[model samples]
Each structure stands twice: as structure tokens, then as C-alpha cells.
Target: MDVADLAALETGGSLWTWHRGLRDGTAVVFDLDGVLSDAASRQHHLKGPRPDWEAFFAASGDDPLINEVATVLHLLAPELIVVLLTARPARVRTATLGWLDRHQLRWDLLVMRKDGDRRPARHFKQEAVRGVRERGMDVALCFEDDLRNVEMFRSEGIPTLYVHSGYYD
Candidate 1:
């Protein structure tokens, strides 16, 4: 299916809430940066006159493994509610949402960190997970690539999938 198909399925309005399972009810929380997209590299800007941000991102998107994982999540975890918790500021929400739209990746909720926060990114993510839990849903798993974030989620008793990267492992 394409992005349009996924968007139509989302249908907005409390999509973040858990859907009752055939046997057991559970929720699936996702990290925005490394889990859903190649957002890790976007944190840094390409330097020099020949810098090609689009090309750089396109190169990363060529990975077959990442696409495979995304497809698996879309199929196997269709019933599980998905949330994209990111430290990205609200200013980039449009671009981020556009990226999600283009990729056809459907998420129930998108939580972006607000500015004027003194806490670390990991702490912010941990708090977001807590908020999700407070909404009366069981977070079955949280997918993140940064080791710091993985540790933060683990400390909160949340299971996490650490996406391995060369620099951050």
C-alpha cells in the first residue's frame, strides 16, 4: 500500500489509544528518530559548499534492511497503537509529518519536545513514555537507536528495541 492508503487508515482522533486484541490488549510505542525514520543523521547539518542534505538523506533511505523492518511493523503490529516520541522541536513538525506522510508510515500519535526544557533528550523521551502509560495503555515495546534513550526507557520498566548504529551503540 502507499502513503495515501496509510493516511486513510489512520483516520485521526485518539488513534493513540490501544485497540483491544484478539486475545490480549497491548500498545506499541515507537521512537521517531531512529526507529521510524533515519532521523539520527538529521540532527547534524552537512557542511561545506557541496553539501547536499537531500542526497545525504536519500542515500540513507536506500537501506533495504530499514525498509524491511518498517514493513514488518506495519503488517505485524497493525492493531497495536503506535506513538512517535521525538526530541525534535515543534518547528519541524510540518517537515516531520510530511516525511511520515511520504513514507506511508502510520502513527497514532506524534509527540514533539517543547522548547525551554532543561532536561536531556533521554529524559524528555522517558517522560513522554510515562505520559503514554498514564493514558491507560500498556506500552508493549519502545523502539530507539540511541543507547542513552534505551537506558532511559529501560529504567522506566519499558521494553525497548535498540537500533544499532556504528557511532552510537
Candidate 2:
């Protein structure tokens, strides 16, 4: 997504709520599905040629918490701004928010894909990180499950930790 397109996308959460954290000059980014949440149960819907995206995302509410990553999130959130950047469409914001709450996950900002956006996850996510940087918040680190996204961020000089969930291979 381009600058204008990105600006048009719906972003949840309040940056102001975590503005103090940003003063430290860095933010930590976390991807939703397959990273913070185990998306294995919903992976089936993404199989075959015409993947049932709606079904895949619709079933996300049932995803189990990825405890290890959650522990890391909890550890960093109190010191650094935590941004939840996901390729999930904004249409599922309510369910997504509920899922976060259910897991007791706290994030300063939530960035979701624009509805009907057909861009690849790598493209969408890279732009989201760029947007975060554009706000003067340096991304100190990122946690992602997709290999493509991990490589993308690393290529851009952003430190990204790959959490394997077997989604990309």
C-alpha cells in the first residue's frame, strides 16, 4: 500500500495511550496470526486454489494463545511501545480485539489490512512497519511467523525474530 492508501486504512488502538513509551525511541512490533496466536486450526481454510479467506479469518477467534510469544510481549510492553501489525482484514477487528483481550495481550496500536486488500502479506506488512517508522518510532525489533515477512523486515534492516509456525513451508 502507498502512503495515501495506508493513511486511508483503519487503525485501531490509541497511540496517545502509549506516547510515553515512544519517548524511549523504539517500538516492538508483533504479528497476530501464527505469531502471537496459533493459527493452525484456521490454516485448512487457506488450502486449495480458491482459499476460503473469510472462513480462515472467521475461525481466528478460536486460535490458541502462543504463550512464549505472549510472555515476551508482556515483558516488553511495559517498557517499549508494542504494535500489533497483522494481515488480517479490518472487518474482523471486533473479533480480533476480543481475541487479544481473551488472551490478556496488550498492544499500543493495532494495524490491520484494509478490507478487500489483495496485496501479499509481505507487501502489506512491510508498509505497516514503514508507517510505524514514519511516525518517528524506530522499530527496535519485530516478531513474525511468516518467513517471507521475517526476510522482508530483515532486508530492510529491521531486526525480526522468526517464530516458526509452518505457515510458509
Candidate 3:
């Protein structure tokens, strides 16, 4: 599929592109919220009824970097295609970019959920992984905090390392 088709398939709504073009090779995927950016402070907003997603994401810019994860990302970026895949919606792209810049985390590609698309994280990320693979890249490994996502990726034959961020508990 072409870029347009890939974008739509990945996002499920309007197209969103980053500065980098698709790279074909071994790719290591990382989940943003819990894995890279420590969203523990803002995860409270997701509790209770009517999960205030806006508030949770709006405060994303202030999320501190997961030092160890950031280090791993930096170490692997120069050698492998680092793909930052997040369940966070795409509307906060600017905030996400700023957060990454502030933390100095580098990634070859960042995939986010489309606005208005509220599928569970596992499903969305699974599709994102497929999209990445379809672009001729092999998803060799993934680092994710969500157990559901970890299971999904492993089920798809991708090796995954699960990090416990305490958000799912």
C-alpha cells in the first residue's frame, strides 16, 4: 500500500505524518506513555467515570522521561529503526513532540491513535505494528508497559518486553 493507504490504515481517520520518512529494516517499537514518558502523575485523570482524556494528554508535555527507557532508545536509535508507538491520540502530536524534544528521546517514527478513534490500546497498537511491517520493516522487538499490548505483540510473533508502570493496576 501507498503512504496514503498506510496512514489511513494506521490512524483510522485523518492522515498525520511526521518529519521522517518510512525506513525499511529491523525496527524496535516502544510505547510512549508508560514506557518512555512517565505518565504516572497524569494517569489519575483516567480514573473515575468519564475519563478526562483531554486533561491526561494535555498534561503530557510535563511528563518526565523514563530514564532507563530513554537510554535504551538512544542506544538503539543509531543502529535500528526506533518506532515510538503510542495509544495516545494524534491531536496531541505537538505536545508529544515537545515532550520528546525536552527529554532528548529520539525515534525514527512515531505512531499515534487517530482523533475520535477510541479502540482499545491493544487493537490500535496491533494495527500500527502491522502497518509498520507492511512498509517493509521487520518489527524485531517491542518495549511496552501495557500487558494487553505485550500479549498482542507476542501473539503476532514479535518479541516484547513488558515494563510495569503501575498505570494498569
> Which model, 2 or 3, shows the larger TM-score?
3
List the candidates ranked by lDDT, beginning with the highest: 3, 2, 1
Regarding lDDT, does 1 or 3 come out ahead?
3
lDDT of 2 by residue, 28-79 (tens): 9899888899999889888989899999999999899999999988877465
Better of 1 and 2 by TM-score: 2
lDDT of 1 by residue, 33-60 (tens): 5666654454344456665545444434
Q: Compose the digit string of candidate 3's lDDT tens values, residues 42-135.
A: 9889999789999999999998889998888777747688888887888897788777766766776778888888778888887878888887
Q: Candidate 2, residue 122: CA error in Å?
A: 0.9
Alpha-carbon runs more than 4 Å astray in model 3: 1-16
What's the CA RMSD for each of the models?
A: 6.8, 6.1, 4.4
Q: Give TM-scores for every candidate, taking all chains together and pairing residue i with residue i.
A: 0.69, 0.85, 0.89
lDDT of each: 0.60, 0.78, 0.80
Residue 65, model 3: Cα distance from true site in angstroms: 0.5
